[model samples]
Target: MVLLLDGDDWLYLHPAMSAFDSAVARGEMPPVTLVFLPARDREAEFACRSELWEAVRDELLPLVAESGVTADPGRLVVAGQSLGGLSALYAALEFPELVSRVACQSGAFWWTPDAPDRPDPLGGPVGGSLAARLRERHGLTGLRVAFDVGEHETRMLPHCALTETLAERAGATVRVSRSASHHDRAGWRHALLRDVAWALA
Candidate 1:
């Protein structure tokens, strides 16, 4: 099963979401399952909150287990964009065995100026800080990560670059792409379909 977390804007019902849905209808994606995680909104102060991760750990995981979309945690994939991207990383890092792959598109890795005492707005340190923990526990042997962002996404470009490096160090197979510009949902939608297919396959 694939989990798609909505961004801070909570605009999952937009064109980008449609692109994924359309791909499924066309059989570009396999007979896959999808789950959506709601967003906290663009103005929320603590963007990617511990409270949110609590929901995934205490609530969502069990739900997925019972639903049986993926009986093996290693078959599960999680994805998101922007703040949602942060939430996806948080989920995968915290429960690596439960999620084998992560696709972060145009991720907002600049939530915190410095790593906070708690998980930052993006749920961890800027640029793959959680990777260290993953390696220590999950060992990073089977983890696969796909990261992509537009070249014009200036503020997030550095974080994206650093995150790719961190994922690699953590022993994950990482892919980085920078062919597009930051143009809302349109710029990122195509990458979502392509990366999801590649990772989930």
Candidate 2:
């Protein structure tokens, strides 16, 4: 299944899924099985929260499989934008066997555990908590990950660049690209579909 963790407004805006379907209709790509797992609380559900992951592993996946979606547990792809993007990568790192592929767009790599309370949150760290976790030497040989950031997002460049490099170093088949717009989904539309296709490839 393909999971989409995005802005509530875009919950109905299945640009990537729609594009995938169009591609399939045109014989460009094969049929895909997709599932949308919207985040209840963006910060709470998508962060590196151990409690949240445990609940996801213990309660969510099993329910999703039986939810009549025709999803394959072994062929999972998690896609998210912005903060959701961070969570997608976090899941790939923490639950490697479960998430075989990841599509992250404009991830908030500036996030730090203490930075939220600090005077300068964005300036406090690069790659934040996820970067620290990536340093743990988690082998991602079986994982395929795609990272795309907005070229106009100057503030997010360094952090995202570092993250892309680190994921590749961790042995994931990584694909990196830049979108034309800023952090908005308008800029992420193409990357979203392209990256997901790459991940599934």
Candidate 3:
């Protein structure tokens, strides 16, 4: 399992590893090798860019493979929140072999190629660029994705809902849910663990 966010926070602030271990102890899910990856440039790296995907596919994954971690290459799960969530789905759409399963929380689906330049980034078209891409793509038959967004994030719901519908329409086995809080990570913690397990299952 690859977790995208601050590594220290994921390890300390949240009991992600402990929760996973407990679930495994209960036979709720299989044991997984957790890989935490923090973003170097939040805006640039997390954007739907080919370069970032290339680097992960080429450099980072090779390093992980060389580390002798006991992980199934074919069953890799990528979990991310907000912008990272968008990037995780991007990886699944662009490189399905590398990222077939994903657990996304509160994805910034309002991101477009020129969204940053707009006065209100979130005020752009629904589902942003990813929606447009999904409308034209159709190779997600093997993908399994779980999408969770905060219930209080009213502005984000439309974008997320459209994207979820498009992904499922394009052949991905998708799961959708809503958390109790806003866009904050604290509210996403439980969903992260639960959704990851669902994706793995």
Q: Pick the candidate with the highest TM-score.
A: 3
lDDT of 3 by residue, 1-201 (tens): 554555556877775778788888988778888887767687898889878778877887778879886345468888888998999899888887688998999999999989999999999999998999999988688999999999999999999999999999999999999988999878888888788889888
Model 3 whole-model lDDT (C-alpha atoms): 0.86
Q: Best lDDT goes to which candidate?
A: 3
Q: After superposition, how far is residue 149 of candidate 3 from its true place, in Å?
A: 0.4
**TM-score for all predictions?**
0.75, 0.89, 0.93
Worst 10 residues of 2 by lDDT: 7-16
**Model 3: pairs clashing at backbone N, Cα or C within 3 Å:** none
Per-residue C-alpha lDDT of model 1 across residues 46-98, encoded as one tens digit per residue: 24556666766578767877877544577677777776666667666666656
Q: List where candidate 2 sits over 4 angstroms from the true fold.
A: 13-17
Residue pairs in steric clash, candidate 2? Answer: none
Let me know the TM-score candidate 3 reaches against the reference structure. Answer: 0.93
RMSD of each: 4.6, 2.1, 1.6
lDDT scores of the candidates, listed in order: 0.67, 0.77, 0.86
lDDT of 2 at 140: 78
Segments in model 3 whose C-alpha atoms lie over 4 Å from true places: 5-8, 70-73
